[model samples]
Target: MLIKKAVLDGIASGDIDLLFRTWDAERVHAGSTQRTAIGVLAVDAVEETDPAELTEEDARRGGYASLDALRHDAETRDGTLYRITLHLAGEDPRIALRAEIPRGRELTALRDRVLHMGDWAVPTLEMIAAQPGVRAPDLAAQAGREKRPFKASVRRLKELGLTESLAVGYRLSPRGKAVLSAVRRATASA
Candidate 1:
């Protein structure tokens, strides 16, 4: 479930608590947390809601001025309407992970994980490090890989605090840089 940055901000500030999405099937469940640009969001509830059942209060909680505005926005998308209750959970853990440079055992573990990512890992990190903020499609093309899989690979790297997503592309996190440096040094020595 994609939440707009504005809505995310509203959630973070405790001004918004409801989200309406039209999806063929439920994409998120109660208790699931999503990490966003603002922070982490906790889904409190997911219920199938009839469009006619939505009230003005729901709209306000969803950051819309009126029920009509909420309905209009919801109708623009196709599928079953689900009312999702959410709150800002807290900070994204990866934010801290990004800043922490890996060392000793931590560095060894990170290096092992990267190595286990097969051949694409180090090169992908190197590519992003060299060309921060370049488009993903362009990066994928340069890497000679399909866009979707390339993005998935980047996401894996991100989960390890090895990459930071940008508006246009990606960059190495500080932790990522240290790990990459260590990997390269180990490879050179080997």
Candidate 2:
């Protein structure tokens, strides 16, 4: 209810803090304004950021120091989290609704629940299950589709309650793991 939207300018390559802030997203001309919701909490780990308007250094100034700094910052701001949506002013010219994990929330767990279900919830879960560590775009590439399909699939998976995200690409829920495990076991038994 007390949500304040923000933007970190000049973000070239960086990561998202999927801990506290959880932006309710829509992919418009700016970041995440497509009138869509992914329901997953995922932070982007920018590796090669290059926004036409924003720069990588600008990203660092906005709120990305290092693992330790980010963790400390998020930990301290957990209660007063400010949701942010990341967008680049580069070729894309539109910002992706970055994250809502800022410093506080009315129901933190709810935000977590939404984040648990991400842009590519199911595939992302499988990728994480297989690799335990992967990237969002990697999942997208593996999905063999463009950005929208990959992002949308993950959103669907989140809507289905099978997966959620936390900064990392994605992880399986108890239900998801159970299902995956069952499938694996059945295949092995067969």
Candidate 3:
């Protein structure tokens, strides 16, 4: 549904090809070929519908309730999907009405211990920050953890809007960098 929202938001007035291409580019970047096909199908389902004429049913058949609903969800979201919307909107001025998704609530439990010598703190965030563009296995190795758990930690951070996925690896998001800085300061002071 988030994908559907992004696709709809990115679709210029009548430009199905442009929408498909944008979705394809994003999906390819994420390396989700299956998701790319799904997004393409959604776009195809409404290739003939103009943006202004888009109705509730059109949005549903496009896998959403309405453009309004999509906008609402996008507005409330603060993860990779929302970030992609921001990026696409920057790339194409025709994409409009994209609301910024602010960083989610702080992980209170993680505040003091974020950089402490622990299982899920210093290692995960430090490695990702130090090696912003490395693959998961390399990051895991550098962090002295295995591939599976390190990936899980990354996913957890992503769910908190603290990290983002790339085609090949992951990187701390703007929110991630801020939180990390705060964590460092807090830990140092402690």
Candidate 4:
């Protein structure tokens, strides 16, 4: 639902456009990787069902009906359909309340270990988060870097519990994002 909300936030408002502008600028400037990841995930997680085609406020109302049908379909197919209804199709706090999602690439000192972190930190966090819950190596490799830098950089994040271990790599912890949301909120409010 977070992913879905992120998509809605982008397309529904101009947040997606702002993100694209920032991402395009970032690519032109320096931190293309983070911007790229954000853009891609935003694009991919967006529902395949076209909101434009659906049209009207009916799309919003149809959300529940659509889920009911999907739920029934999943039940018949011997698949886990509640997951589709309850998880993905559901509204998310972070996405619905954009205040929870931090904008920009500002890094503040939450941990002494990460105080003077590298330029990659903010973007890395965004990248890891865009896919939330991948492994360290894969997350690093996903951002277009190598294993060593990815592993080294994720140390402070690990300490902060922003990421967790997978069989081969790492993925984001939900709590980590909640922390990020708080930090972003504090900064924005300030």
Each model's C-alpha lDDT? 0.92, 0.43, 0.51, 0.43
Q: Supply the global lDDT for candidate 2.
A: 0.43
lDDT of 3: 0.51
What is model 4's C-alpha RMSD? 16.9
Off by over 4 Å in 3: 1-118
lDDT (tens digit, per residue) of candidate 3 on 113-190: 355436676568777888888999988887778999888878667655667777778777766677787778766877
The window of 10 residues in a row where model 1 has the poorest summed lDDT is 1-10
TM-scores, in order shown?
0.93, 0.35, 0.44, 0.34
| lDDT of model 3 at position 121 | 66
Error of 2 at 87 (Å): 25
Q: Which stretches of candidate 4 lie over 4 Å from their true place?
A: 1-116, 135-137, 186-190
Query: By lDDT, highest first, what's the ranking?
Result: 1, 3, 4, 2
Give one digit per residue, the lDDT tens place, for model 4 in 56-147.
Answer: 23323324235444334333443111111111223332222322323244223342223346667666767766765566666767678897
Which candidate achieves the best lDDT against the true structure? 1
The most accurate candidate by TM-score is 1
Write one digit per residue (lDDT tens) for candidate 1, span 70-184.
Answer: 9998888899999999888888999899999989999998998897888999899999999999999999999999999999999999999889988899999999999999998
CA deviation > 4 Å runs, candidate 1: 76-78
